[model samples]
Target: MRYVIAVAETGGFTRAAERCHVVQSALSHQIARLEKDLGTRLFDRTSRSVRLTAAGEAFVPVARQAVEAADRARAEVEAATGVVRGRLAVGAISTVAAVDLADVLGRFRAGYPEVRISLRMGMSEELIEGVRQGALDVAFIGLVPGTRPKGVRVRKMAHGELVAVVAPEHPLAGTEQTDLRRLAEESFVDFPTGSAARRQRDAAFEAAGLTAEAPFEITSVESLAKLVRANLGIGMVPEAVAGELRGLHVLRVRNAPTREELLVWNSLGPSPAAAAFLSGLGIDPSERSQRSGRSERSERSA
Candidate 1:
């Protein structure tokens, strides 16, 4: 049956044999054996071509469906085994996750000692697609301003405020707070244009009617932190990320928009390990908003 499908796809026994990495004679023998067992002529043979016979055409769909079903069954078994012992692929943007994801993941690992976790770091856009495509069980990404993809669920994990980070000894770092207009006057370490962070930064600057002179562009948050530590120039980063840097002082800007960190996964459902991890993080998927509201009310009362 496999040989027949291969031959049908390849359109020639010799080509199918080449694809299957066997001699053409061996392929022909196997097909003949299949025909004998089925008692039907599966293919119409000619000097120039091999075409599926009427019976072969009828069998093709059933054979394809069976193959697909078998493959899905195997995948299901593997996934079920992963409930206790399997790998979980997770994605994250470099700068955002550097802040609080370590603590969350550490707690998750402590709770699910049997499941292995692998982390892939990339930009927010790429990580979103990865989650939607099932390449990643979950991802952490900066909240895109307006656009959202279909077939992915998102939860607000944390709110991140944009702040200017500078070396502790720098002049502006000593100020209690800085306005965006004054901060824009200094040479800046900028993220590449079109990035989520850059877009938010641009919007803030636009609102303030200011422009920044950014001679240096950096991609990594760690590298940006190192740059600030050297007193090279100031850069805007999430407060959580900047707080984690030892030598940097984070200053709040008067009116910068806050960036939200989100936990994203396929809309169909989360893997068991991912659900377990979220549960350990104190996030109930179905009741996140209600829980958040209750916490807010308790805080206000307190």
Candidate 2:
């Protein structure tokens, strides 16, 4: 169609060939083959120039329209198939995966059976970097205040209340809720010093005029929970994770800090499969609007 249109518009074989960046003979052959296929002469040949016949004139507009429509339809199909059948790489913090991500992914897989989903677990900072570098399509991370990386979008997926956890036999375990001062006295099983969780914990202690002195530092939440279960120390953890401790008692904090569980992704945009998977997990763009409204309401009330 392009070749035909060029020839019609140029009104000469040599000019059409020049416009199409093809040799004149090749253009002539292509037009000849096209005419043969249609069983009609598409051009009237004269020694000086070429002109469209009545049949050619009638067919040119319809041919161009058909070609344009076919091209658009092909593009749309490719975009849709890209969404339906591709790999979506995702990352999550270990605790989030244990608490709720597996179920979300399970539902996503059931809906998009053709999409291959790969989930990696890592620290929140690492996951954020992964999404920023295009290594991950999206991630579930512990939210950090004032730490948004450039070219990445962050959405809060859930809010978790903080809780103090201790071994069942620990003295403070029997309390309904404990004060920060009392909780600070015990040895702590802590996240890495610079971690988002650790930052929040430190800020909370600072606000309450107390300090956490962890004898040991462990990066894994599962390990931190286990250490707490062994009477190693009292640790602050998200309620979702604390609820999973079998032999530990999680005490509510009288005024502990809360953390947002966030979904982070590159600003470059999502593949069709990734977008569909996110939608299936109920984390569509509208969910972000709803969360923002709730946060605003909470702030106004506070």
Candidate 3:
């Protein structure tokens, strides 16, 4: 049923297998067996594309509902067992987390002491992928506004700005509200190319009608801070990360972009632990169900 939902959502067996993290052959075999047992074809396949058969259109909604109901039943059972206690992997964008992730985790620990929480930080894209692939329960990320990825649900958390960072002893540290073009001639140690911080930096440069070259790309915000502290180059980071680095001074950009922060999680097949975490955070589960229902409706009417 999960496979069927994935197939319908993604529109191809190979893509569905990727979403489900299974090999294409294995996913295909399972669907074939299901069809053989049900005595109807679920999909129409061609060399270039795949579409749901009429039978598939009839079955996918029920399949999605079944999968969601099973998840809810399991979560309810676990909730009744006592406290919400299980391992949960939580991801955050390294530079900015709207609610002070450590504080939230501390409170969550105080309430559900038995729940083992692992926090990992990286670029928004990578962390979102971690949540989508079921490796992480939830994430706080810098999301592009007005866009939501399939297979997960997100809520806008906050909009915050990035600041140019330099060591206190560096030449640019004393300047306030510096125009970004001033640094166009300086070396830059920045986030990886596709990271939210890097994108904002690029936009800032464009706004200034200048280009800032990043000769060194670091994945971790801490690493970028260290490099900047060592006089490697100027660094661009969120205000929160700058606060953490000793002696790092923040220089404001004239027209820096405000990051759209979001709290995102896998809605399709949330584990009991993930569901509990969301509930504890007061996140509504109905949004996911509604989104799923809409997708299933679209597929059914196709």
Whole-model lDDT, model 3: 0.75
Name the Cα RMSD for model 2. Answer: 17.6
Instruction: Quantify all predictions' global Cα lDDT against the true fold.
Output: 0.73, 0.74, 0.75
lDDT of 3 by residue, 1-302 (tens): 89888988998888899999999999999999999999999999899888899999999877865775575566567778865656678998776656877888887778777667899987777777777666677888774334355566776677677778887788887787776668788889987776565776776677668897899898888888888988889887767766777878888877775566778888675666777677777777546522221233111100
Error of 3 at 238 (Å): 1.5
TM-score quality measure for candidate 3: 0.67
Per-residue lDDT tens digits of candidate 2, residues 20-128?
9999999889888989999999989999878899989998877865764464355346666553656678998866722367787888788878767899988787887
Give per-model CA RMSD.
10.8, 17.6, 9.4
Angstrom error at residue 231, model 1: 2.6
Judging by TM-score, tell me the better candidate of 1 and 2: 2
State the lDDT of candidate 1 residue by residue for 70-111, as single tens digits: 643554566576544455678887776433777877877877
Global fold similarity of model 1 (TM-score): 0.65
**What local lDDT score does residue 128 receive in model 3, on the 0 to 100 scale?**
74
